[model samples]
Target: MSAVRRLAGFICLLALLAGAVLWITRESARPRESYQEIGLRWLRDEYRLDDATFEKVAALHHAYFATCSQMCRQIKEATRPLLMQTRRQPLSTSTKAGLRQQEQKLCDDCELAAKKHLLQVADLMPEEQRQRFLDDMLSTLETQRLQHDLDMSAHTRR
Candidate 1:
């Protein structure tokens, strides 16, 4: 009787352990939401947006982000050659200047696109929330842009 009880308890323990491991594995594999989604949710909650408005906002948000992501990839690709060039040998002053100019152009274009997207998103928000949203976003964007500019300038100098 004791052996039978011990065997039953052992089997149950193994079953429980297996179930836990499976659950953990499944959870680890689950997809996570992007920061864009989190921003959309914040807009909905903070702006007190209706479902219909939220749907429009979400569509615009996603479309803008898709384009934004593509541009980011392009920027990364553009920088790769510059990075490789520097790693292999020192560049001539003019060559370095040209590469830096190309990078600056890409960064400027991205900033413009982001500003345009912010304007479009603000247009969809409530009248009261529109300026506030822009203020919050543009201020944050400006700060980040300035910081990035500073970092790039410092990087180039070094």
Candidate 2:
């Protein structure tokens, strides 16, 4: 009877250990968000959006990124020739001026695209939230643009 009792106790301990291992594996397997995803998560949580609204907003967000990415590629392509020239010789004054103007126009176009997307998102927001959201987002966008300009100018001076 004592041996039987000992055998049952050992079996119970094994069962508990197996359960613990399974629990740890499941917990550790939970997926983590990448840095980029955290911004989207913040937008959802900060705006207190419902699932349906969030879905629409996320769709718009992704579309804007796609447009913005193309603008970035255009800027890169526009500069490629100048980059190649700079590697071999200094750029002519007119060439530098033309490239700078082209870059500015691309940046302006990208900004306009961003603003239009922001307005669309604001339109979908609740009436009470719409103005506030626009105000916050536009202000944030302007802040980022200003910082980017500052950084670029500083780099140029260097």
Candidate 3:
């Protein structure tokens, strides 16, 4: 009877341990892909993105998306006057001054955000990796620029 009780207690302890492990494992959550992922998907679908290019594209996009989000917020704040005054053909001088101030604030915010993000990225990445990342980004930009020029040339020829 004593042996049976000990076996039952051990089995119960094992069951509890197994349950705890399963619970912890099940609790692991998937991180949602950032807005960068959406932008990258759009690029991939619209353009021909190779594997090597896609990796860099995604990383560059992550940085750009972060910057763009900050810029968009600033832009919306800056352009609030144009959005708000739909009824008026011309805004008053005071209103124009307010708009100018908002635009200046937006530009300042964008500059600050870019500075802060670049500093953070440099801190996080190794020197070589950061250089490589920068090169990759510049290459992507160059490719896009070339494509745009070609597109314009084609349109002009037509």
Candidate 4:
């Protein structure tokens, strides 16, 4: 009877451990919020935007996200071949320069798109809030761009 009780206790502990592992795995696999969602939420909270304003902001964001996604896909498709080629062999100096130029152009286009979207959003705000919105959004965007540049430079050095 004592052996039977010990066996039951062990099984319960194993079950609890399995449950914990499963919960952790699910939590880790959950999708994180996209940049657009986070930006919208921050704007709403920071500005105390009303429902109508938020709706307009959200609509603008959704449209911009579609454009941004398309541009990113185009950039990725354009660059994939270059990346694959580089993986196989050393690129000629001219070829590497051309690739870098192409990538910079894509990056510039993305930045322009983001700036346009942010400006449009700022336009939706009241007179007093417009500058604040632009300042905050642009600051956040610039910070992200700088971090991205640093990370890319680090990756290339590796």
Candidate 5:
């Protein structure tokens, strides 16, 4: 019937619109670069680091990234069970507490690794540039941390 055809067309049009909106939302939410990439780029531009210094910094960055990536995977693996348990049934208080502690420890380890890497990079910088580099790097880290926390909170709310 003509009415049925019209109804089907309307539904298809609505579906297309919904898909477009979802695509736009996801694209907007995506970051242009990883935080580490952004930090490295910022350091290169802001400090005008020499080639040798840049190479050393890059090496440290790469090493730290590897460690961080491993930590992230471990955390994700650990959290998966907790998430599954929470979804399937109520978890015991002790189990929940243990999971939270493990998560916190993983986060702390990652933070410590980053701090050590930053210190190594700072040591490589000239005395004159060291303070400036630290100031800029700390600011960048704080901004990124705040943004990450905000994003996590928003995600959890959903």
Candidate 6:
């Protein structure tokens, strides 16, 4: 009887642990638009943007991000078959070359989208406000990059 109870308890504990892990994984994998939204909020607050201007900027930013995401997904889908096939087998020279080409193309596509978005944003803003917005974006990007590097280093140490 005691052995039976111990076995049941162990199973229950395992289930609880699995549930906790799934919850954490789902949360982490969640599509977080908070980074972009918060950036817009900061721009409004720090730059004292009026509500109408803020709304227009936010709309434009959101549209650009949406379009960028769609473009990225399409590119990924296009290369995914070859990429997955290469992953399944040992990499040949040809496979490596194809993969490198795909990777470079992906980078170029994303860069193009980013440049287009920046140009659109610049066109939308006045000269002074545009400079401030650019400055804020630069600082935000630098801070994020530094944080990412720190996180990677910490994980490597661990």
What's the TM-score of every candidate structure? 0.82, 0.68, 0.39, 0.68, 0.61, 0.53
How would you encode candidate 2's per-residue C-alpha lDDT over 1-158 as one tens digit per residue? 69999999999999999999999999999998865468678877877777988888889988877787899899778655555564347677788678868877887888899899999988777787788889999999999889856755554332
For candidate 4, the clash count comes to 0
Per-residue lDDT for 1-158 in model 5, tens only?
A: 69999999999999999999999999999979878788788887777888899889988998888998998898787566555664446667787768757866786776677677777899998888888878876787677657745754443333
TM-score of candidate 2 relative to the true fold: 0.68
Off by over 4 Å in 4: 1-35, 78-88, 154-158
Model 4 lDDT per residue over 1-158, tens place:
69999999999999999999999999999999988799789888888888999999999989988998998897776555455654457667687668767876887888899999989988888778889889987998899878856755554433
Best by lDDT: 1
Candidate 5 stretches with Cα past 4 Å from truth are: 1-39, 82-88, 139-158
Q: Report residue 8 deviation for candidate 3 (angstroms).
A: 62
Candidate 2: clashing residue pairs, number: 0
Error of 6 at 70 (Å): 2.3
Which scores higher on TM-score, 5 or 6? Answer: 5
Number of backbone-clashing residue pairs for each candidate, in the order shown = 0, 0, 0, 0, 0, 0
Q: Tally clashing residue pairs in candidate 1.
A: 0
> Which of 3 and 4 is ahead in TM-score?
4
lDDT of 1 by residue, 1-158 (tens): 69999999999999999999999999999998889889889889998888988999899988988889988897777665556555447677787788788877888899999999889988888899899889999999999889977866665554
Scored by lDDT, model 2 comes in at 0.79
Write the candidate numbers in order of decreasing lDDT: 1, 4, 2, 5, 6, 3
- List model 3 lDDT by residue over 16-104, tens digit each: 99999998787776466666677667655544555765666567657777777878777777666544554445667687667767765
Which segments of model 3 are wrong by more than 4 Å?
1-34, 38-71, 83-88, 132-158
How high is the lDDT of residue 38 in model 4? 95
Q: Which TM-score value belongs to model 3?
A: 0.39
What lDDT, from 0 to 1, does candidate 4 have? 0.82
Please write out the lDDT profile of model 6 over residues 42-79, one tens digit for every residue.
86777667788778889989998788788768666745
